[model samples]
Target chain A: MAHHVRTDYGDSDPLFPSKAAVFWYAVLIAGLIAAPYLLESYYLSQLVFIMIYAIVGVALNILSGQAGQVSIGHAAFLAIGAYFTAVAQKYGLPLVLYLPLAGVFTGIAGYLVGLPALRLHGIYLAIATLAFAFIVEEIIARWESVTNGNEGLMLPPPSLFGLKLGTEGFYYLCLLVTVLVVLAAINIIRSSTGRSFMALRDSETAARSMGIDTARYKTTAFALSAGITGIAGALYAHKMSFISPEMFSLSVSIDFVMIIIIGGLVSLRGAVFGAIFMIMADPLLIILKDQLPLWADMVTHGLYLPDSVNQAVQAGVSRVVNAPGLKSLIFGIIIIVFIIYEPLGLDGRWQRVKAYFKQFPLARQRSARPPRMFLKSERR
Target chain B: MLDFTQQLISGVALGCVYGLIALGFVLIYKATEVVNFAQGEIMMLGAFMSVTFITTLGLNYWLSFLLCVIAMAILGAIMERLVLRPILGYPQFSIVMATIGLGLVIRALVGIIWGTDDLRIETPFTDGVFKIGALVIAWDALSIIVATILLCAALYAFFRFTRVGIAMQATSQNMLAAYYMGIPVKRMFSLIWSLSAMVACAAGILLAPITLIHANLGFLGIKAFPAAVLGGFGSIPGAVAGGITIGIVESLSGFYLPEGFKDVAAYVVLLAVLLWKPQGLFGLNAVKKV
Candidate 1:
């Protein structure tokens, strides 16, 4: 095996490893930009949703993946952001003013949540956030004076300056925001603050000993994560044109967590991949629901079983497929399977595949496998 | 004052149910160090199981309850073995997520099997109310409180006197140490899961009379978090105390406080408790060693 040698520090330090990488990214961006022209409005809207979810995944990755603070209630922050946008719009605030304000306000909320979080660790922190989420949901429902209570809030079409955004225009807006957010996330991860977060996540005591102000960084991570998620929420509010407390339920929070996990944690690209998967899973499931029963009948038709048995099998398949909870069941199964088998998520899998192709015939099977991890007991 | 007394009684009953569910959480957390987010779902399954045995199978009420508890115990053991055993030493976060997934799966399964409608479990004590001096207490409430006390006492004795119980205690204290001492740490984990599931089933059966049986009943497990945390996550007695306190606070708040406070009372208390004492009421704070 030959190792490629770098001639200078700049060669090794470049953001894009090679000209090919830069070209690929350029092509990817170009494809994204061209997507609206080729795709239907429905798919364009879905792309907007993907970008929004990607923003949230990135936000959560900053807090959870980088900082090692597990939050089971991030939807609360999203709720804050959406409601902020809704209320700000109600006051005739411009998009530019309210979008940043939504992030800032949600960041403030994150800071408040983080104060209590400073003391809590591991599962306790997760539960506190969970409790915080429940409280936020309740407040949204009961404080109808501003939130409009259970009736929910409706918004006028989001406008930039005085111009209202159509599907394509909004897509561009979301695309611009998504690109900025992703770039900002990458920069944060590369910067000293991001390094400190990693240090804190790896070992808070060690980080503290090394003069990293653990408290400040932890809170900062929370604020940054929540702020980005809030931005996503703002876009989400605009995209939907209506907001409700139910929209930001515990399930949505779980979905955000699922994105980072499925997309692969601790990587910006992973967040995007996870967002795509999360967004796509719903329609995929719907398609599967329709096709599964027919396929079941098809397979059983060839078997030449008795008519009664065939009918019974068909009925069972249809019932399971038609069940309202089928989506959750599939999601639940996927989450469990991923945790057990693919803990590194899709990004990890992608890395392995890339490594395999790079190595070609000489690629060792062991090199592609996830490294075995010992159980690190969290008894304390 | 009489009204207050009646509310208190019902609150205690409600708290006992919470305590029982929290006890399931504490038991699993104590032994396996894995917080079973699906414990409430287990309770829901238990309730649904009993409902099926009674309404579908036409079993006697007590007989169905017994069968349901037994079945849930077996299911819990199976779950621990199949799902949890592989990821025993993983990070708390992964385990938490897995359990949350398991919860979704269980709730969804229940929905598929039982349909999404609310279900009623016709218990022997469903109708009667105990009246004393203008105070009315439903028999179901009284049964819940009584059953909880009895269950706690039984659990106390089991932990104190039984060989398996002592082994479980040892294992919880130090798995490696217990293993070296010839305790079957793996079996103990299975047993703890089964025990926790049984407790959850009992709580579910008791709660079904009041809350009705629904796939979403597993959400009550969320409320049990405060109870478990308030008692400190690992302490059994603390779970009960924290649960009772939350229940009473919730009950009283619903009666006196403005609309919407009741729903959030448990969480408010939880946040306050977490802030005031992160170690919880009965929990011993362990200083981390580098």
Candidate 2:
């Protein structure tokens, strides 16, 4: 095995890290671009959703992961963006105009919400965001004349530059936007702005002492995060073609938080990984539901149990599988298990695996273990 | 004036339920600094358990209530030991997420076992109504208020007079000092969970008659957040006061404000309160030291 050892500072300064990394990035992007041809419409649509959710996950990572601000209500931003597009479509606005406007409107909403966040910290801020989400949902429902109330709004097929986008075109569009957003995120993370956000996360008092404008940066984080999420929401609305207040409820907000946490906090790759996991998990579960009974029967065939007992067992399993809340139940369990066992998330696990391979025979068992965390008193 | 008084009584009764739920939140937060987002789910479970004891098993109402409370207390203790104990030292965000997960799990399990249909529990006071002047109040609402008052009194007595309660208080005040003083701090945590769970069960049973028992009943816990926060996160009395204030505001808004404002009244007040006084009405401000 050969290592690309950096002899000069400039060798390690580029975004790709090494020639091999650049090659891998090229291959990944090529594969993604070729996906529409390789997969059916159903799978292609799923990929579009994965890309869209990845945008939200990346945006949330900027706030919660880099800035250490917990938001249990990011779905509010998504709702605002989606509604912006929906309402804009009603007024006969073009995709080019409404799409960016969606982000701008949602960014303003984020700025308004972030105002109270200056005085609030930790759980208080979380609660404030929660309240804000509820208020937004209520406003959407009650302000029926504009939002269509509970009836929801219908979106026309999206087009760009007077050209109608088919399913494949939409996928490519999402791919293009996702690539741009990821690149922008990378630049932000490497820049002074990202460094200041990280400083604020580590400690506000320290960041303030270091002359970082904590308030301005905090609001900046909220606006930037909300704006990115808004863009994703605009795409999402066009994809779904219809939107309702019920679609952007509290659970959606929780899902965004789950994405970043389960993907791995503080790592950009984690956001993409988390989005993939979240988007794919639904189809995976459905597949499991279909195959589970056969698998159960095969394993139990050797037992030769009574027909009645076997039927009862199969019925029980089917009932559990068919339960409406099973998906959320499994998601809840996964979150708990991850929080307890793998707080660093899927990205952390990947990093450890990479490190273990890099060290090979030299790797110690304890080397990959996370540091023990002590109980930090919330009391001042 | 008549309609206003009627709404006020109903609000107070609804607020008492919120207070009891908020009490559960405050108890767990005070002892462990973990916000149990599943408190409402626990209350839902309590309601379902009572329904099983009363309607399914044909037990007397009072007997079933006692049994439900005891069962929920054990469940709470077990929950703390199993899920919360291992993650004690993690950041507050992880714990909050875990509790939210717990809530989702509980809701699902209840859906699996009981099915998702709404359930009704018959109480002795379900049909009775009290007529005073031009106002008519249902016995269900009145009983909720009375039960809440009694429960609060009992809890006050327990904390003020009992050795275990004092120990729990000590643990909440300063966990390290309490451990140094030979108090079984871990046990105190388990006890606090059980105590809060017991209170939650009582609230659930009281509330079931009014709201109807359903899996989504736990979402009421969201409303209780405003109550708990308004009262101050850790203050027992504050939780109740906050709950009542939210309840009154909600009821009044439902009547006086435009449609749909009632649903978000608690949250609106919560945002306002958070903006005005982040420390809460009863919470003492603490400056962080770097």
Candidate 3:
């Protein structure tokens, strides 16, 4: 019925409703609501993880997408937030009261960090932030009394309104928080503060010349981004029921960057796309792994593979397939291809496609400049 | 007092390793104005390569060390041509993001090959501790410092005396003018990468024994990054000075300060220094043209 109804659909006919787009969103919302009810506890937990990651994606977008601040050490802020929450919980502060407080502390750290970073632009700032990240991890590892060092301290399930928020309950919590966050972010980006950030992003010197306080705003941008990221971190710690330095590594930081790039860097829609892309990519890759043939079998059992790689590949394929590194190698190749060719990323490509469809009925895309003959009589 | 001297000697020796890595970063920045963050990963590879050749393939340590430098130089050169050249003259952010991608790819490659093994190499130098009344210093420490001085001297001569080296310097000074003089700017760019990679390899080969070689040895990349900033991003001499300062400061702090203060003390120094002197000790303040 849908295929028949959508046979003549194109961008030119705005009056004609696209059932596919409508149905996709409708199905997404329905599935999201029903996920906990339908799936087992394990799958529900994964979804909760995805939601937390989405929050991270949103926070990072505030810095990179909106403010042109390239931070690769955001995971440190997460660690700060998580540890703060843990400490708060351990010290008998109510979980709900302490979570937002953790974000405030993280924001303060971000602002302080940003102050130094602002003095040194771009690459220099990145190096400083990277140092901050390493230093944070080292402290977390060394401070046994507080962080319990590498062994990690555990947190009981967060209780909100006298009901313990288990994984299924956390899903609802994450869901509610995610909606509020998404709406808040949308509003913020539409507000004056967001515009100032975008302006600063596009051109700092020009923005300043036009009377924008680039310094104050840059720090504020960090505060806003870090504060949100901190909140997500606090939430994430409770969601996992455990926290460790290994969970927040340089690799995870890169994961956020990769997500932003694949989805879109400069678009709001990109955040959604990025979060979905990252969350879905792992399982999709796993499924793809299960579908491979000859070469896969040999590589899976290659004698050269170390214990970890062997175990991971064996687990992912289960029935004997390709090496774990092979999947990563494929992912690497794709990133290489994207960085080389479509540096603007998938969103940019999507815009061009939409433009092409918009011009289809006319058989030519309209432009201000006309044919060669018309150019000669421009003055007349 | 004896422990203090030993700590100082050990810090300086370890710092020489950071200095060498810092030298690589400065070289890359000098030539192309791009910092190769994957430098630590490259250092990691160099150490792993030396390990693989010496331990696995029955090669002498000295021979493997020399070959690793040459191999890293080639890798660096290839990286410039392949990954970096394509993104030439883009915005700093784009170039940065691209290099990070390159770094990830390189890390993954290293992991695939080595499989995250913590490795060890037989110390090529004699293990002896020298004592002067109250002060004690390991032979490796003194040797590493001496070796660094000799290496720095050789590099100095290369840049000062050789044609390509002078061309590289000129290119670093002003790419357009160098091109005008028929310098072949592209060659200089690749030459910078090759030189930086060699420097990183040398650092890795020297420091592998002391640090206990591992894939995570790359973490020092970030640590040494502060050395670059501290020395001033564009100054070669600054790299050495910054590294030694950090090393001594780190060691002394760990001893003097209460538990956990030493870890962040380096960054605190970095922040303080950056706040006080944004151009760094050796770095020239960038003149903003209005």
Candidate 4:
């Protein structure tokens, strides 16, 4: 009932100094260590947020990518985790105890939600989960009894073994937690449970006929997915030092999908890649918003655009030019383009590029075969 | 008693907008097998266009309304052709994501163009209020009821008597079979999409007089989704019934029950309906070929 764990390590040579692998590892490792030092604390904080999202996104990949389920209301589970941590911390629960308790709270909620998911598959299950997301969000927004409604509750600083952890400590906590989560996810996918999830994904009918407890496995997958995602939410709230319903909106749920899709949904490396890319985009786009107009003037007026079209093009430049909304428009277009051209997502393309380099000499000897296999694999 | 009647009437009127939007949801779902979550955003954008027609372009409310419906219809056609058609053979999950993404893009664009502030829709028909037997009823609630009944009747007539409507229904029923039978299924989808957007715009126009026109007005569309589900996803009549039921139930619940529960009443009904009968109130039962 297990998946081919060797799928990940199939092409990965342990001995050979593959040029692309070395370059990617070197870049990623250096960037990860250097990021906190190179960027301002505010930017580092943004990166921390991105990493938290990456953790949730990767966690969700288990249910979505591996289990073949579409969940649009992931933020509800996120809120449960965040609010659990916030409440526990508020009521004087110790950090170590509260964190695990937060995970348990969300895990049970996920399991409960997944119960209905047993009967419904695909789109219907997605909508039910989405509805649940809405329910939770509204409760958080309106339930003044516990949640503090729209205003949200404040969280006290986390303490462990008599040390008050500040923002820097929280950032490091998020980073360490995310790395550990990614490593755990990678290991899980290599384990039997991960294979069963994939088996469910490939064909639930086959998986069922093969004596897999389809209902139990599906629900368990969701619970497991929620466990990791909820922890990410807890970490996110702890980092922000506050918990609000607005933080876990429908849009935030979509952002997780964007990260997973762009990162190549099925890859373990995608968790890190997605975090760094999205983290960079977080600040880079803000800088580019101003620089784009200037850069446009410089590049278009001085260099690329024809004299006739340049003025017209500059005039039609949209209303939300200053806000992050324009970047959103571009991001939407990029996603559409990505879905159409590179549906395997960025990691899929990265794999192709890696394979091209890794197998350059031998594959160059028979280049036509690789391209054919590529076209076939990408058809879905 | 007056408060009760006023709330009931107003709730029913607002429910009609949900019904109309739900109608579009059912139509699109029937034709393309896609539950467009972006339909509300489409309605919001339509309202903005209608506002632009009346306020900016200096037209009468009736003329502006008709013109905006046509414009919305055209936009819908373009969307069906440009955005949706390209992704036709892809999985339903991706299609849902794509439309949700499109909704975001549209919402952002609308916000940028119209600013975040709410706009007043000065429909002259909404200028008066009347009282009946100790009940105060606004012109808005009355107009919405009349407009919706008229629209539903007209839609029924169009679908029943028209060739394109029958072809559309046939296409929705069996795409490959309809194609084999010489039906223009592709054109039918475009027509359905345009008609769907037109219906959503109708709701927007109806909704605008009662409420302010803004980016946030689209939130009603989310509420209407449960209405569609509570009815059959495939049944036109069921959509209307579902909307009215939700509206009345929500109004009553908000009045009698605890506060936040009203927000979830539609879903409560949905969950109940799903548990009892998943195909919805009017949906045809399907026996899957194992």
Q: What are the per-model DockQ values?
A: 0.74, 0.80, 0.28, 0.29
lDDT of 3 at A287: 74
Off by over 4 Å in 2: A1-14
Give interface RMSD, every candidate, in order: 1.2, 0.9, 11.0, 5.9
Minimal lDDT window, size 10, model 2 chain B: B281-290
Residue-level lDDT tens digits of model 3 in A1-380: 12333344344333214766568766877898898889988678777777777777878888888888878788998899999999999888886788779889999999988897667777777767777777788788888889999998798989887877777777887887776677677677777788788898877777888899889988988887788788888888897779988888776776777767776776656666677777777888777765664345478666677778866765655432343355445555556666666665667667656656766555344442222221010000
Candidate 3 second chain TM: 0.96
Model 3 lDDT per residue over B149-248, tens place: 9889999999999999899999888777788999999888888999998988888888877777875788787678778889998888899889888888
TM-score of each: 0.98, 0.97, 0.85, 0.89
Q: What TM-scores does chain A show, candidate by candidate in order?
A: 0.97, 0.95, 0.78, 0.84
Instruction: Write candidate 2's Cα lDDT for A1-380 as tens digits.
Output: 46777788656555766678889999999999899879999999999999999999999999999888889999999999999999898898988899889999999999988899999888988889999999998899878889998899998888888899999988998899899999988888777899899999999999999999999989999998999999999999988999999989999999999998899996989999999999999999999999988877876676888888788889988889999999989999998999999999999999999888988999887989999988777776
**Among these predicted structures, which one has the highest lDDT?**
2
Off by over 4 Å in 4: A1-43, A166-168, A299-318, A359-380, B287-290
- Which of 3 and 4 is the better model by DockQ? 4
The reply for model 1, stretches above 4 Å from the true place, is A1-14
* Residue pairs in clash, model 3: none
List, residue by residue over A1-380, the lDDT tens digit for candidate 4: 11323446644423223556568766875786677778888888787777887888787788888888778888888899999998887778888887878778898998988887876665567677767888788889987889999998887777776798776677777767776787678777777787888888877778888888889888888898898888987887877778889888877777777777667666756655666666677567777666666666776777677877887656555344664367666666656666556666767767777667766665453443222211001101
The superposed Cα distance between candidate 3 and the true structure at residue B204, in angstroms, equals 1.3
All predictions: root-mean-square deviation over Cα?
A: 1.4, 1.6, 7.5, 4.7
The candidate that achieves the highest DockQ relative to the unseen native structure? 2
